[model samples]
Target: MVTRKLAAVAAALLTGTLSLTACSTGSSGGGSSDPGDSQLNKVLKAGELRVAVLPDFPPWAVQKADGSFEGYEIDIAHELADSLGVKLKLVSTDGDSRLPMLQSNRVDVNVSAWTSTNERAQTAGFTIPYDAHGAGVLFKKGADITSYQDLAGKSVSVARGSTNDTILTNDFPSAKPVRFDAISDVISAVKTGKVDAALESSYTVAQAAKSDPELEAISNPPLDPQLVSMGVLPGDQVWINYLNNFIRNLIASGEDNKLHEKWLGEPLASIVSVQGNAA
Candidate 1:
């Protein structure tokens, strides 16, 4: 009996030792795997590129009556997926939802025309800028405002929670900022003369002006220019680099200019020009 008990105790000790060794091996294997391999490899393995986009932002992205998305960013998203030899899976998102979708891993990347700000850079990685624009005011063609300073003591419209709103509140505190939920609403307010002007991105303002004969977009002094980039989850250097290369290729091949002309009605601005290219 004593011999049998001793043998049982020895077997238990050996089993525990093997279990510990297996755990250690598994951990070491995981640690040794290249960090950069995971995100890009997972995307390739899935055979579909998931991208988040805003559907209501015209010229950048627009949702059609048929429920399909179209526009410059949509085309760009499709092209990126094509380059990966993967199907494009667009996850419809809004301005507020884009970053959350990326952080939660619901999408591999966000092509929502995000302005790369210092505060945003802290949370996510941004590829080299694909577009550059500044803030401007859109108003009726004969409106009194001629410069940013003219906004003083005037009622201006801005999308709530946007950089434009922040700019108005922080810089032009004297201006009465009428906040709206959508950029469309801000534009509408200005169009109907409910507001004297609407502060918005230069591209958006320009598009609005082109579409409406009574409206005009002006950026005389040019508010802070924003560099728009694709957003990926933080720490994905591999994915960021790939996107940067893809953007460079798009510029070199003239696809970027094509899209810009198709949507914005002009060749893409020199602001988007790559290092070696003449804008």
Candidate 2:
């Protein structure tokens, strides 16, 4: 029965776009909501909700060997499917490949940990953020670098197509930015001394530094961090609004922090300021 329901939802979502009004009734997330109330309804009706995920990003979204997904994003995606009243179908990909899944319509939506930026915004519409943290360069302990400008004419390695890449590419056009296939590889680049410094999300860098004592973090550059958002194909206000309210409700209900701990293993309080509209 659930399988049939997912099939139905897929048909409708694939048929065309859905208006926000058609999916959301401005109704509050009053309970353990079903995916039926918001833009998720379109997916539920289609009988299957195609969700893109990246397993390499721990504490955010990770794929398990048993075929189940682990991490905060996966937990929330499950909640999203529940709210939409459909089955949650997982589509796996890395950070660099997630956008392609969304663009090709191979997946209906991307719940993989996605950082929003002006460049990505042009390709995909974003919901409000679930997590926000700054990107910093990780160097060997006792390094002399103070800011992004200090890295001038030096080799900088970053995850391909990540927000850090967009920022460094646009901000420090003179710096040499090398693209690694994954965030982990970029992190490895720093430890391997393949690059002068490696740029990565603080969440990942902090985790890496905790386990390895040699990597030192440079706090100054791009003091502004990136906010992670749910990615959707453009023109789905119904889905967009649904996701926005879901995120807002996540913060309001305290589930946001709970999920953070569930996957990240600690409360990431430093990024709270980036959770909503900035001051």
Candidate 3:
């Protein structure tokens, strides 16, 4: 059922462009605030922190069958709310909805597995990256693919409007990208032999490989590292600064590494080092 829906969404995205609607309702947990109030002050006064998180991204954030969210980003959200002396309100989001939720004021911060890019920086303020990953291809174990160049003239799948989509569209023109609405769809397409391979985050590819012995992640001549960070609306230096400091504290106190180990089964990468400088 999900696959069929994703197929329709992908077709729409391919023919048209992705569209996001701002949420009409305010956050459910936070106290009401005047429209004119600053976001930082509003959250502080309301005693609730609304955080947007991806419900589908594993090891980062995932919604369980019981409707509860868990993973590294969920834990980080809890800590952020605690630091601010506010209750945490988790707002479920996806690749397309995460930024819109933040921009529409439906959430205070986006802790989704958001990678900081120059284009996104124009519209959103980002805390220093908490994690880093690179784009890679996930293919069947016996596939002949060994490098990025090997994908030329082949069909590859990617999540539409995602960093991987942009990478393939801009950097690898020879390969055809079968754009999907969700990463799960990309994985499904590859597993089912609907596409030759799938281009996505190395972490996601690794997780997929663990579940399916036939799948493997290839990073020979790795793509540019994507810096995963928390996002807020642009021009909020105060909030951005606070979030950055919070992230720094997480790293310095070793809590970040702990979460990484618990969820990813590995220590935090050195590339995700603490960035204490103000934004």
For 1-279, candidate 1 gives per-residue lDDT tens digits of 011232232233333321221111112112111323435556667777899987667888878899999988999888887777668888887667767786677898889878888987776677888887678889999888889989999999997777788889998999999998777788899989999999987778888998899998875856987888998766655556556667877776788788878887777667787631732
TM-score quality measure for candidate 2:
0.74
Candidate 3 residue lDDT tens string, 142-194: 88898888889889999888898998988889999999877778988999999
Give the Cα error of residue 134 in candidate 3, in Å. Answer: 0.9
Q: Candidate 1: list runs displaced more than 4 Å.
A: 1-37, 219-221, 276-279
Error of 2 at 15 (Å): 16
Better of 1 and 2 by TM-score: 1
Sort order, lDDT high to low: 3, 1, 2
TM-score of 3: 0.81
lDDT score for candidate 2 against the true structure: 0.68
Backbone clashes for every candidate come to: 0, 22, 0
Error of 1 at 28 (Å): 23
Off by over 4 Å in 3: 1-36, 219-221, 276-279
TM-score of each: 0.80, 0.74, 0.81
- C-alpha lDDT values of all predictions: 0.74, 0.68, 0.75
Candidate of highest TM-score: 3
> Which residue pairs overlap in candidate 3's backbone?
none
Tell me how far the alpha carbon of residue 177 in candidate 2 is from the true structure, in angstroms, after superposition. Answer: 1.2
- In candidate 3, how many Å is residue 232 off? 0.4
